[model samples]
Target: MSAADTTTPTKVPLPRQAPPPTAPITPPGRRTSGGATVPWALLAPCLLILALVLGYPLVRLVTLSFQEFGQSQLWGFKPAESVGFDNFAEVLGDGEFWAVVVRTVVFAAACVLFTMVVGMLVALLLQRVSGWVKTLINIALVASWGMPIIVATTVFKWLFDSDYGIFNALLSKLPGVDMIGHNWFASGPEGLAVITLLVVWGAVPFVVITLSAGLTQVPKELEEAARLDGAGAWGVFRYVTLPILKPIVVMLTTLSVIWDMGVFPQVFVMRNGHPEAEFQLLTTYSYDKAFVVNDYAQGSAIALLTVVLLLGVIGVYMRQMLKIGEVE
Candidate 1:
């Protein structure tokens, strides 16, 4: 005891410091009362920019839809007179308008169907192909996708030219299938079909890329398990793959509907910027009303209606996405 006490000094305990100030812990999937405001604060600048850029135009469009805005008013010779829903009534009552609506819906549906099927097939092919082959196909798709709309339309026009077109040339080679001098744009149905093809061609690239990325995320174990459970190729795809791919498919279909319904440049340029009455979709109809007839109010009304339809589609898409997220 004497030796130990001499060698070692008496120990003294240091006082513990209080814990540093910290934020209150939030449970997973829950936020603090103030957390909701944080995101809004960060988004404020972007919201402001969007309001500045789009708000005024949208307001003007709505106003125009409810007024009688014409060339005279546009030139400042007269003020726009309020017409209430007259423009909407006129558009809604027009038999041609209804016809155009039906045609537009069918065209968009066909385009969406073809685009999804072809895009999915190509995505599956990409998964099975050699690396270099897939790379080449991707390059081709990107090249087509990156092509200017006007340029692509013009190219398609040339390809279907009645006087000298490779399409007719190629078809003529088929035994007894004389397609020489066949005018693809002579009829509305034929012309719209060609336009559909063009649209599908341009749209497939994005669909392929998106689906390919999604396919990578699918669990291989589930696929193997399905196969082991006596699922054939089609059975596995129908039972396993399709369920997982539903969200992407729905999103793509909605977007395609919006785009295909709003198809203007392809139809316009294909017909030399003067699409025939038979060729008119909602976008072209609006343009024709506003510029060709100098009826800006009616044009705005049609455009507003188109926007409503698109909003409906978007709402459905958002609802489906939320449901998918909830399921996940």
Candidate 2:
């Protein structure tokens, strides 16, 4: 062994194992190389249904708005004649139409403001509750949200009915109040107030539930730190909580505005296309002119205008919210 080349035994290096075959890299949500295909295939049916139900009607309505779609055309076995922008011109020329548009804008603003404020309070309160209390409140809110719009409108109409209504009965009980024979439905302003009440009441439940869910995702440690720094309840919420909740609040507010602006059931039940033209909203007005007055083209034009206005308003809101978020 000591001799230079005599009997030296060499240790053999173990055969280098190829790095364990790298597991085929897959993108999240994909089970295979063709993962995206199946999901899209599954979604195709829903998309087709939506196109048939929503897209077709929207296109038809838009086309109808540009035609002379009077009752004769609507009923007769003939297509409507293209009248260009005549229906829009007539609708836009009416000063009364503009008034309703302005009134709808104002009404929507008020409803959104009311809904957001109450919803914010309810969401904040929910944060402080626990266990069964929270569960019970959630159940109540869900029930209210699940209620049908038409049924809710009927309940509200009955409550505010001039004769044998619970609301008037309560008003009559007030000190020195002679509201027993009061006709709340006869007055436009008062009637509008009832509609607003209905809108706000029905909307707040949704706002509260959505906002509460958002609040749960907020980091509690941040809130506790703010409190530890001698920040009062209002200070903590205004400076810490609200900043985190801004996106949710903005989203809910935008939805509320859209819903209230296009509200129909409550207005229909309360006003029913009466002489109180002052209380009419876009939806009710459009329905009246289209169905009640038998002018489909005019109604479609108004509806198209409503869609345009809603889109514009929502776009502005989203832009503003995004800018504010970026600045903060």
Specify the highest-TM-score model's number: 1
Candidate 1 segments whose C-alpha is farther than 4 A from its true place: 1-38
lDDT of all predictions, in order shown?
0.93, 0.86
Please state the error at residue 8 of candidate 1 in Å: 18
Model 1: per-residue Cα lDDT over 1-328, one tens digit each: 5786678676899999999999878888885777779999999999999998999888989999999999999999999899889999999999988998999999999999999999999998999999999999999999999999999999999999999999999999999999999998889999999999999999999999999998998899999999999999999889999899999888888898888888889999999989998899989999999999999999999999999999999999999999999999
Would you list the clashing residue pairs of candidate 1? none
RMSD of each: 5.1, 4.7
Alpha-carbon TM-score of each model against the true structure = 0.89, 0.86
lDDT of 1 at 154: 93
Q: After superposition, how far is residue 79 of candidate 1 from its true place, in Å?
A: 1.7
